[model samples]
Target: MRVVLAEDLFLLRDGLTRTLREHGYEVVASVDNGPSLLRALLEEKPDVAVVDVRLPPSYTDEGLQAALEARRRRPGLPILVLSQYVDQLYANELLAGGDGAVGYLLKDRVTNTEQFVDAVGRVAAGGTVMDPQVITKLLSRSQARGMIDSLTPRELDVLEMMAEGRSNVAIAATLHFSESAVAKHTASIFAKLRIAPSTDDNRRVLAVLAYLKR
Candidate 1:
C-alpha cells in the first residue's frame, strides 16, 4: 500500500496524493519530474508508482523512459501510468519485460475513484491493467466488441467514448450534454457491461495480451 507518485501538475499531484491517502495508501514520495521520478523509484522502493507519461526537462517521454529504466534495474516493479491519451508504443515498451504488474490508464479514469484505487492496488499486487481506450485502439472494431453487449444504443455510444479515453468534459462536448449527464451515462455503461465495483478492477488483462500480440 506504499506508493510513489510522479506528476508535474501541482493540482493533479495533490489530488492523487489525497485520493490515495484517503483510500489507505501510504504515499512515501511525490515528485514532479522524470529524473526525480526515476531516482525515487530506486530510493523509495515503493510498492507501486503512479506516473504521468510526460515530465519536466524534455517534457516528452522522459517520465516513461525513466520508468522503463527504473524497471530495467528492478524487473517487475509495479507501475501504473496515467496519461491524457492512449500511446500504444509507450505501452508496449512498459510491458516489455514484465510478467505483469503494470497499468496504463487515462487521466479521465481518475474521476471514478473506486476504480482508480482498485487499479493502484492491483498493479501494486502484480496485476496488469489497461485503459479501455488502449484496448479499443489496439483492437479492430469487430475484435473489440465480442466481450461487450447488452448495452443500450446511448450506452454503447458512451462506452465507445470511454474506450477512446474521453473525459466527461470531452464526452459532453461531443454528445452535447452536461458533464453530470455524461457521468450518469458512464455509470450506466459500467453497470450494463458488468464492470463491478473495486472487487474486480475489470482492469482486464486481455488488453495487455492484445497489445503484445500486435
Candidate 2:
C-alpha cells in the first residue's frame, strides 16, 4: 500500500519509513511539517497516512488538522495519527465523523513493529484502530459521563476490544467466548448506546465512540 508520513523528528520519521517499507508498504512521501503533509496527502493520494499529532510550524495539532482537512477534501482517506501522549480531544475529533478508516496511537507503539504495521493495514482497509492506552483512558473518563455504565461487565470487555478494531471472531477468540455470543453482545452494545442502524454511517465505529459523545 502507498503511504504518506508526517513526523517532525527526523530519526523517528526515518525509522517508521524503514519499518513500513520492510513490511511492504510503499512510502510515497515523507514530510515533516503540516503544510508539506497536506500537500503530500492531496498530491500523493496515498492508500494510508501516518501522521504525528504535533508537527513543525505550530508544533501543536498541525498534523492532525492537515489530516482532517485532507479527509474533508477526500473523504474516508485512511489516517493513523500518532501522539506522544493520550490526547482524547484529538482522538474524538478523528472519530467524530464516524468513519471507520482512522486510527489514534501513541508514538511509543512504533517500537512494536508488528502491532504498528497491523494498525496501518487495518486503517487502510477502512477499519478503526485505537491505541490500548487511548482506549483505557477513554473508558476511565466515561465514568464521569456514565454513558457506558449501563453496560454489563462482559459487554464492557467486548466494547473495549471493539474499540481496538478487533473483529467479532478475534474478540471471541481473545475472550474465549463463542462468536455468536460476541455478536449478541455487539448487538446489545448498539442498542444500549442508542446507535440506530443507518445506511450512511458505520454503526460499529459509532458504537465504539458512543461513550465519548456525552
Candidate 3:
C-alpha cells in the first residue's frame, strides 16, 4: 500500500517511515510542513495518509487542517492522525464527517509498532479506530450531554470497544461474553442511540459519531 506521512520531527518521521517500509508500505511522500503535506496528498493520492495533528508554519493544527482539506477534496481518503495529546476538539472535527476510514491515536501511548501498523491497515480498509485514551475522553464529554446516559454501563463498555474497530467476535473475546451477547449489546446500543436502521451508513461508526457529537 502507498502512504503519505507528515511529521515535523525528523527522528520520529524517519523511524515511522522505516517501520512502514519494513512492513511493506511504500512511503510515497514524507513531508515536514503543512503545505508540502497538502501538496503530496493532492498530487500523490496515496492509499493512506499518516499525519500528525500539528506541523510547521504556524504549528497549531496546520497538519489537521491540511488533512481535512484533502478529505474535503477527496472524500473517503483514509487518514490516521497521530498526536501527542488528546484534543477533544480535534477529535470531534475529525469524526464529524461520520465517515469510516479515520483514526485518532496518541503517539505516546503507542508502545507497540505492530499495533500502529494494524490501525493504519484498518483505517485504509474503511474502518474507524480510536485510541483508548481518546475514547475515554470522548465518553467523559458525552456524559455531560446526558445523551448516552440511557446506555447501561455494559452497553457503554461495548460501545467503547466498537469505536475501536473491533468485530463482534473480538469484543466478545475481550469482554468474556458470548458473540450472541455482544450482538445483543450492539443492537441495544443502536436503539438507545436512536441510530435508525440504514443501508447507507455503518451503525457501528454512527454509534461512535452519535456519542462524540453529543
Candidate 4:
C-alpha cells in the first residue's frame, strides 16, 4: 500500500519507514512537520497516512489536525494516528466525520509489527480501527443520558464492532449470531441511538459513532 508518514522524531520516523518498507508498503513521502505533511499529502495522494499526534513547531496536535484537514481536502483519505498518549478529545475529533478508513493507535502498538501492519492494511481497505484504549475512554466518557443510556449491552457490543468497521458477517461470527439476528440488533441500535435507518454500513457506523462522540 502507498503511505505518507508524519513524525517529527528522526529516529522514530526512520524506524517507521523501515518497518513499513519491510512490510511491503511504499512510503511515498515521509515528512517531519505539519506543513510538509500537508504538502506531501496533497502531492503524493497516498493510500494512507501514519501520523504522530504531536509534531514540529507547536509540538502539540499539528499532525492530528493535519490528518483531519487532509481528510477534508480528500474525503475518505485513510489515516492511522499514533501517539505516546491517549487523549479522548483528540480521538473524538479525529473520528468526527465518520468517514471510513481511519485508525487511532498508541505508539506502543507498533512494537507488534504484525498487528500494526494489519491495522494499516485494514484502514487502507476502508475499515475503522480505534485503539482499544480509545474505545474504553470513549465509552466511559460518553455514557450520558438519552440515546446512549438506552442501548442494551448486546447492542453496545454490536455497535463497538461497528465502530471497528466490522462487516455484519464478522460481527455475527463474533457475537455467535445469525447475520439476520445481527441485522435486527443493528436496527435496534439505530433506533436507540436515533440514527436514521440506512442501508450503508459506513453511514450507520458514522451515525453510531456520532452518538458515541456525544
Among the numbered candidates, top TM-score falls to: 3
Which model, 1 or 4, shows the larger lDDT?
Answer: 4
How would you encode candidate 1's per-residue C-alpha lDDT over 1-214 as one tens digit per residue? 7899999999989999999999999999999999999999999898999999989998888788888899989888998989886666777777665477888888876678887998788778777777766666555443325545556777667656554334567679998888888778767755654454222222323332443234
The TM-score ranking, best first, is 3, 2, 4, 1
Task: Compare candidates 2 and 3 on TM-score and give the better one.
Answer: 3
Residue-pair clashes per candidate, as listed?
A: 0, 0, 0, 0
Q: After superposition, which runs of candidate 2 have C-alpha atoms over 4 Å from their true positions?
A: 109-111, 136-144, 196-202, 210-214
What stretches of model 1 exceed 4 Å from their correct place? 140-212
Task: Give candidate 4 misplaced runs (Cα > 4 Å).
Answer: 9-11, 86-93, 109-111, 135-146, 175-181, 196-199
Ranking under lDDT, best-scoring first? 3, 2, 4, 1
Of the candidates shown, which would achieve the greatest lDDT relative to the real structure?
3
Which candidate, 1 or 4, has the higher TM-score?
A: 4
Q: What is each predicted model's overall lDDT from 0 to 1?
A: 0.74, 0.83, 0.84, 0.82
* Candidate 2, run of 10 with poorest lDDT: 196-205
lDDT of 4: 0.82
- Tally clashing residue pairs in candidate 1: 0
Compare candidates 3 and 4 on TM-score and give the better one: 3
* Candidate 3 Cα misplacement greater than 4 A, ranges: 136-144, 197-202, 211-214
lDDT of 4 at 17: 96
lDDT of 3 by residue, 1-214 (tens): 9999999999999999999999999999999999999999999999999999889999788888899899999999999999886667767777887778899989988889988999999999888888777877876756434647778989988877887888888789999999999888888877877665333224566555655567
Candidate 1 vs candidate 3: which has greater TM-score? 3
Of candidate 4, the 10-residue stretch with the lowest lDDT total is 140-149
